[model samples]
Target: MRGLLPQLVMRVLAAGLLTVVVAAGWVLWDTARAARRDAQTTAALVSDAIAARPSFEGLAFGGVAPTPVFRDWQQFPAWSLIAPGICVELGPRDQPIQRRCGPYLAAATPPDWFVWLANRLGLVPEPVAVPVRTRYVSDAYVTAIADPGVIVTRAWARTGDLMRVAVGMAIGGAVLTGLLMIRLLAPFGLLLRGIEHLQRGDFTGRLPRLRVAEFDRLSSAVNDTAAALQEAQAARAELTRRLFSVQENERRALARELHDEFGQCLTATRAMAAAIAQSGESTAQDGARIAEISGQMMDSLRAELARLRPPDLDDLGLRPALERMVANWRARMPSVRFELGLAGPIDAVPDDLALSLYRIAQECVTNAIRHGTPTHIALHIEVGDAITLTAADDGSPRHGGTIDSGYGLLGIRERVDALGGSFVLAPVENGMRAVARLPL
Candidate 1:
């Protein structure tokens, strides 16, 4: 859990960067294409402007041109314009016969656009083109071509320069976008820290209110959950303290009951038997009667042990425990009737929960007998992911005041609550019903 946050953050950042890169790359590609098209258009326009001028025809002839046309052309510095170069006029046999005004050619292979335009314009053997640098110029120079071809070749160079600019902007944009994302995501760090503190059993921290509405709601929800958990933990601790106290008292009570009741009775009975055997006056009938009484006393002691220890709870299980409890109740009040709906051999409940269930039933029965004075009682035990024990008595309520609860009900409630269960008592027709639901 401690390492979960860093791992989540890394995953989010990796995904974000990947998405941004893919999207930005696509956008940049489209921008490059659009820039190339615009460059081509500008290049054609500039070439046409130069070629349409009367001064350019004389300039092309080397017909004593003024310095201004050359100066003006040089001053037009733009990505679209193709640089000046030489051309050629063709003779009847389609051979280059004269040089035309243009810049010196420099390219290992003529640009494809240049060759296409020259052929389409019927300017065979006379090539017009944009010069590209090479180790050595091509032997096929001074040929016919047109201005558009030059512009097309220059469009590539201009597009190359625009690509560099686009790349710089894209990088800067990606960095800025990353930073903004980090800022937006920073509050989640606070939320995660709060959760970590809660996980470590520190539920006292107050979450900071967030500017984002959803985050604010989340912070509030977490604080509420923490508060509830803290309260529950405190209640559990208190219950445990009380339970241990009760267990210690019960242990002492059991020890005292054994020593004072069973132990003293056995010792007196042993002395009486010894005297009867030693005395000549003692009759055989008297000895038999004493032996019978001693046997009964031993049986009683064994029964008490069985009641206290409850070995059958582990062996015969919850069904027997509950049956024995009901039998004991019947013995105490023979006239009182009970209808039990025991869901037997219930899917093996946790040992602690089974004990709690048995104890809660005992408490309800005892309460019904002592307070409700009910002639009839109903008991039901249900089992599943949780266990529910319910007991109801149909009898008149005590008229004077609310019945005060003794250790019986308190002990049952403590046990149920210790295991994170709920206990409720409600009026059921003419009597009261006690219900306990414990998580298995």
Candidate 2:
């Protein structure tokens, strides 16, 4: 698509051209009208002058006479050389018309094309016939005609200077406007390039200060945005590294626990079975001890599985899983009061949205308890046009500002980002609040 500069320039040129056309047309029209009037007046006066002649009065009573032509009107140029083309025709009513015109004076002839247009448009006046009258029966007729060439020639003479000025002014305005537009839009290219860099994920791109105040502010904003994005990218990179480390450590712990606790428990059960088989009987005390080992193993497996993907989530869906999680946390932190609020159709959320919301809430709660040591923590989940999950705690204030990025907070952000949701972890009311919203 064409930009504003070219469009504005074209409009400006078009307006100037239109103005010139209108002004030139008005000037030509006025001159042509005046020229036609002068031709008509000259014809009338010549007819009057011819009727009073003694030669015509001495003619026969039947008014049968030769044509008398007068051509002196050409000697005196009337309004804009109009009289030059005037002609006087006088003759008996039944005879051929007489042509009596003067030497048609012309300083310059108008172009054939202009004369053709004037004639085609019928702007040139037709020859007018005026009857000669006397005391006796009058048979003389004087006709006046103005040449189309004369009318066009006169019109051009009157309008040429103004048209030239209009053309010059138009050219000057276009040039000045183009130059000014070019200067005004110079910064647009730089801004476009900087924005392209951002689109390409090259946050390192920066724009320079511009002379125009509005463009300068935009340049500064671009520079600031690039800096902010660069910083966020670096933080995310660090977060990835730390998160990977945390995952590896957790996996190692799980492996160690499996080897130490599970191996021992299975080994002891094997030994007990061997002894019981040898003894050919099952003792109550031995059965109780075996049951205790089985309980410990089950507990250990549940804990490891919870660290990965909670079994409750897959089996019971989102709401129940969240309820179980809260129950577990409440059992673990009996002194810390917890509130869980669920609204709207929580079950209608899709798998990805549910997972992300659950993770965000889980992370926020863990962070509040682990870092902030809050006495009261609240978690609320709402599902409508969008799925919203908010977790807040009455803990020590990190201040009512953006949360400092940590491994847990990053994990929460990652999940929400994957689900195309916005996440904010900020301080509120002497506590921390983490909110996430995902579109349904």
Candidate 3:
């Protein structure tokens, strides 16, 4: 949109310039034509006046001397002024006549190119020849040459001045058009920048009101969109935070119930079994079997409680909890290698952030083992201004697969988004990589 303005402006300017040039050419041509017609009429009137002069009629009839008439013709005031370029003389019909040429009709002749152009346009008038009517002669005639250079030169000067004015107007129109375009598009620039901010997740940016009606409508629409996005994002963050809180609370409650009620029941059953086996009627073999079964039940219950919620997370902090979890996975899957890289002060991290990171890492490792059939898994956690967790497995990529809500990746995404963080899960060259970043 920004790039199109200059092109539009240039086209308008070119059109305006073309219009002015055409108008100037037309005006010059018309004025030159009119001047040519007027100069021809003026020359005709001068010729009629010369033919009516008695001195000229007497010279043509041979009743008067040519010397006196020629002298008088040159000195005549009206003829000298009106038809200075006209010449009058007497000669035999068989002889060539030579007359003294008068001054040019125009005070100053125009340039050669201008005169040529005027001639091409048919502005130059033909000479007017009028016969002097007399009783004695029929062949003698007075010739009047109408020179239109004076009129054409003056018209050309006027046309030149008008052309200059037209050019100035064209330039001024272009300048005004440019300024108007800049003013109209000013609001568009602001709107574009605001949209860029929104794309970067900075929804707080707003577009200012514009004077143009269409631009104002666009500005209002953009502002509304930004506000809606900001509101929706805030609501989603709050909802995610509440949901995670409730889920953690539920896990803790379930773990407590398993430990307090179920664990106590298992212990009481084991004691009763041992007491019965100790009776005189019970064999030593039966007592050993009963004791072994009760011990296995208690061990299974403890493992179930740990799976629900790890007590080490609260007591030993995040690092030790993760190390224990990884050790357990290594024990379960002896064939697969597990690597952990922890950096920064993990102990100083807030409980909620540490839990979110831990849960995400645990889910990634579980997915790698269950689905990816990975030979090696790498888990890395770095804490600073932000906490970054990355997990990768060197196994077959999980191609064309989706994770259900029960798979735990959904929960990790919610937790990360709640903290205004980013989560990415993509296939690597050898397997899959999961990355989560949470702000400190």
Best by lDDT: 3
Candidate 2 pairs with clashing backbones: 69-100, 70-100, 70-101, 71-100, 71-101, 71-102
Candidate 3 lDDT trough over 10 residues, lowest sum: 66-75
109-142 in candidate 1: lDDT tens per residue?
Answer: 4457644643553332223332212222222222
Residue ranges of candidate 3 with Cα displaced over 4 Å? 1-4, 47-51, 54-165, 168-187, 206-225, 252-308, 332-336, 366-376, 392-403, 406-410, 424-434
Estimate the TM-score for candidate 1.
Answer: 0.42
Expressed as tens digits, the lDDT of each residue in 1-440 for candidate 2 is 99888888888888898899899878877866765676677667766665555344324556576433334433433453326656555565457355655345574766777667667656667777667665443676666676666667767666677778998898789879989999889999999999999987688878999999999999999999999988887787567545645664576577567757876776677577556646646575676567566667767766765755665766788889899889999999999999999999877777645655776787788888878778999999888888888898989778533345644766676666545567888778879888888878
Clashing pairs in 3: none
Cα lDDT computed for each candidate against the true fold = 0.61, 0.72, 0.74
TM-score, predicted candidate 3 vs. hidden true structure: 0.64
lDDT tens digits, residue span 67-96, model 3: 223224444454443443343333333442
- Give lDDT for model 2: 0.72
Per-residue lDDT of 193 in model 3: 91
Ordered from best to worst TM-score, the candidate numbers read 3, 2, 1
TM-score of each: 0.42, 0.48, 0.64
